[model samples]
Target: MPDLLTDRLLLRPWRESDLEPWAAMNADPEVRAQLGELLTREQSDAVVAGMRADFDARGFGWWALQVRATGEFVGRAGLDVVGADLPYTGVDVGWRLRRSAWGNGYATEAALACLAFAFDELALEEVVASTTVRNVRSQAVMRRIGMTRDPADDFEDPSVPEGPLRACVLYRKQAR
Candidate 1:
């Protein structure tokens, strides 16, 4: 997939250099809270490896996000198949940024761009995003990107342990 650019961010393919910071970001407790667990460096490395392979085979997956002017890796935001069984199934949009990058509207900006890519470039009819009910921050990002939540579509994420993270909220946006 071609790189996507907004006024302040660039969504592009991952680079070898991103591994260290990516691992650090994944290891952050605040970030991991939404994800339900912190990832080890090796686990984070494996994720990057899998994403790189996905991009190689599919032409699109999660893209590394950066500050275009500074070239600093903020985090990743892009499209991917919703791998787990859920009430909805198809391509989904997601984002994660360093703690320093939070409250900057970067997630909303990058997600909107990915939605455009999904609806226009890929001609997909819809895109979905889900987060634990506790993750109000991510739900806010979903709302900012014009996704709407339907209570009827919400479900417990089977992959999560039965605890604070198990109950999930789902949101979706249809191409206009």
Candidate 2:
């Protein structure tokens, strides 16, 4: 698939060349602290490969986010269906970026694009986003994009190991 461009960024499938930078960002302790576990280089490679395959198979997954002007690979943001076994199985929005990309509204921009795709192109019924209890930044983006908190929807991530951030705040927005 080709890249999905926003005004300032290019969201595309992962390429072999993206492995190093992706691994570095995923290895960052601060970034990994929020995103669950730090990925080893090999693990990162597998992740990139899996994302590529998933995109090919499903027509949508997290797209590698790149700065359009500089061509710098920032990170990724896109729509994913939470595991089928989970309560929420519809499109779910997500993002992760390098430390340098933080505080610049890229996450929100990329996420908005994904939501547009989900609601407009995919004709999805709804999109949900969740963040660790402590990840206020992510929670803020969810709110800024019009997702409303559904406290009843919040649940311990059956995926994350038991820990301080195991519980998550769930937010949802229905397609108009």
lDDT of each: 0.92, 0.88
Name the best candidate (by lDDT): 1
> Against the hidden true structure, what lDDT does model 2 obtain?
0.88
TM-scores for the candidates? 0.97, 0.96
Query: Residues 14-50, candidate 2, lDDT per residue (tens digit)?
Result: 8777889999998999888877778999999998888
Q: Return the clash pairs for model 2, or none.
A: none
Worst 10 residues of 1 by lDDT: 79-88
| Residue pair clashes in candidate 1 | none
Residues 1-176, candidate 1: write the lDDT tens digits: 58999999999988989999999999999978879689999999999999989978877789999999899999999999987566679998999999999999999999999999999998999999999999999999999899999998888988777898889999999999
